[model samples]
Target: MADIQIRKYRDDDAEAVKEVFTLGMSEHIPSSFMHLLKQPPTQMVFMCVFCALLASSKSILLPILAVTLLLAGARQLVSYMFNSYIDTSLKKDLNYITETYLEQKNSCFWVAESDGRVVGTVACLPSENLPECLELKRLSVRRSHRGTGLGKALSQTVADFTRDRGYAAVVLYTSVVQTDAQKLYEHMGYYKIREFVIPELAAKILNFTLIEYRLNVQGD
Candidate 1:
């Protein structure tokens, strides 16, 4: 509820922006691991492994230990997936915020600063897959700053930027594990456009899905 300032991204804010994004993305690992656990394939594999070990070794302790190890491995996989994504993002547009968003035509990035510290970030650029529509990306707020409307304000920053540029709509992709984001976007008038499984082998095997949402600002 403090006075939060939303302004154009600056070069000096690079480290803060990356930190916000990394922390935000890291927060989802637990949920993603749970998602993996809920997958039928994962459940079946765990059950089979546990039962086979129990029958062969005839020791409940060994089977329990094996199952525990498998669970730890699954959690590690989830962490790896999230970490890889964070690393890729840092090496991509985030690595060149000025060039990718600030200097590019019809593209921009903004950071939300509270009490002189960068606490949130959001960016928009012309969508590659949807002509005349801007894609909202890199929306993140520091964990300590959540529940204070920072996320909603960052989202509005992207929407206002898109509308001012005469874009038809704003489109974004959020993974299934990001339930709070799905709610936030829907609450802000973004409608679900479609959902599709990520094409990567690990994602495909785990049934990971990304939901696309669009907010029509043409007539608003």
Candidate 2:
């Protein structure tokens, strides 16, 4: 913590920032796959397929193999979903951090550096859907640097930025799989405003949900 420095995003830090984000998002693949497996639809389909295969082939090995393959495929789908999001973000705002968060009004990006290497990132911008509110996005900390109050420090950075800009509140969205993030935001005085499933065929089938949380800085 003594070596960590939180400051504005710089051009040279682009690659490091993206790496932190990609790695952070990739770390959730296992949990997301587990979440998919726990869904009722996923369980029902796997059970039906396994029973059908077992009855038809009259071979436990074959059914087990088939189920294992299905599980692997499901895990691949979860990985694909997370990878796609990473790619999209890279191609979008992340690809143009300076313009998206630095040059714009009421928008900014920050990175945490430790011994001259970027280890964490967080950004905020005016919310598209919520008036007088700023949306916190891209909050990520390197795995090796987690559990040292870095996440809370980054979150508080956003809250302080929002308050300084006269924003009423700060809103952020995190997937249901990110339990730790939810807890961190809650501990920072943020409240759950709503939850919604991603409107994609695969996401809908898997019941993938995103939760929105809001921290009121104006009143506090």
Candidate 3:
């Protein structure tokens, strides 16, 4: 770990972060799941809401509703079917840094480098709506570097950054399915604040729960 150095993301880091992001996603969720997630926002949300309406209503519009649901479901199926044929691609981890850095706010990225390569990264962005809360995201470590305390160090760096910005608290959300992430948050002094899920996907997926975790940075 001596060779591992953490530094802020520069414009040159864009492509590197994208590569890391892709690597992390490929190592995690199934390709099928990523397909549904990557669907066009308009189509995805429309189909989700369409399903919700169809489940609750049974009236003269049932035929139209049924057709829409069938089409949406078929689209989802097609998306998954063709997903394997495309060249390998992964979610861009640069999303976190691009969002924050572009805002010109107190948002930043920390890259863990070793042997002249980026092994991991953590990103933090101050909450615009909730001043006391800092939003942390995109904490990822390469597979070969796990269990070497890099994650903890990345988290603590975010905590320190939040404290330095005079924030009283830090807040983040992670899927309940990620038990390891929950454990890490708890270990970092973040307590479970609430558990809820968006009504649309709540019944479609496993567990269907999202946990909000928070930590007091100013000891408040």
Candidate 4:
């Protein structure tokens, strides 16, 4: 965390910021894919096949697990449906970070830089879901920088902005795959206000729940 500086977004930072974001988010695909594989549908298929062949030997369990892991790991990187959103956001938002985030009256973006390289990012903008509250958006800390308190630093930037601007509260949304993010938000005094599962077939099978958290800026 040496020489870490959190400051206003700069025009030249778009590429580095996008790189950090893309890489940071890509790290979740492995865990998320594994989560998907552990769902009822995938599990039932794998277990049914394994059970059908159990007569072959008691030593098949390790090989079955290894194969399952390999397939899921491959899908994590090659499944366009599972990862297009992250790539889309990078192409669309990073290209217009200023116009999308920095131009709004009550919105701003901050990047955490260490040793002259951007390592994390966070942004706050007026929430469309709640007009009185600010939405904390795109809080990303590089994988190498986790456990170093970079996440709290980035989140605090948004909280500080909300308080300074007299916003009623701060709100954020994270998916079920991001369990660590849920912990971080809760640790910062955010409370889960809503949860809903995606209606898509695959998501329904995986039980992909979208969670919304809110923190009162004016009180504890």
Cα-based lDDT for every prediction: 0.92, 0.95, 0.69, 0.83
Model 2 deviation from native, Cα RMSD in Å: 0.9
Error of 2 at 218 (Å): 0.9
Best-to-worst order by TM-score is 2, 1, 4, 3
Return the TM-score for candidate 1, rounded to 2 decimals.
Answer: 0.97
Instruction: Report how far residue 166 has shifted in candidate 4, in Å.
Output: 1.5
Per residue, candidate 3 scores C-alpha lDDT tens digits across 102-210 of: 4557787888888878888888787756777888877888878878888888889889999998888878877654667788889889999899853544223322456
In terms of lDDT, which candidate is stronger, 2 or 3?
2
Q: Which stretches of candidate 2 lie over 4 Å from their true place?
A: none
TM-score of 4: 0.84
Question: Candidate 2 overall Cα lDDT vs. reference?
Answer: 0.95
Question: Which of 1 and 4 is the better model by TM-score?
Answer: 1
| Cα deviation of 136, candidate 1, in Å | 0.3
Please give the distance, in angstroms, between residue 34's alpha carbon in candidate 3 and its true position after superposition.
Answer: 15
Best by TM-score: 2
Estimate TM-scores for all models: 0.97, 0.98, 0.67, 0.84
In order of lDDT, best first, we have 2, 1, 4, 3
Which window of ten consecutive residues has the lowest lDDT sum in model 1? Answer: 199-208
For candidate 2, write residues 1-220 as lDDT tens digits: 8889999999999999999999999999999999999998899999999999999999999989999999999988998898999999999999999999999999999999999999999999999999899999999999899999999999999999999999999999999999999999999999999999999877887799999999999896
lDDT for residue 144 in candidate 4, whole number 0-100: 81
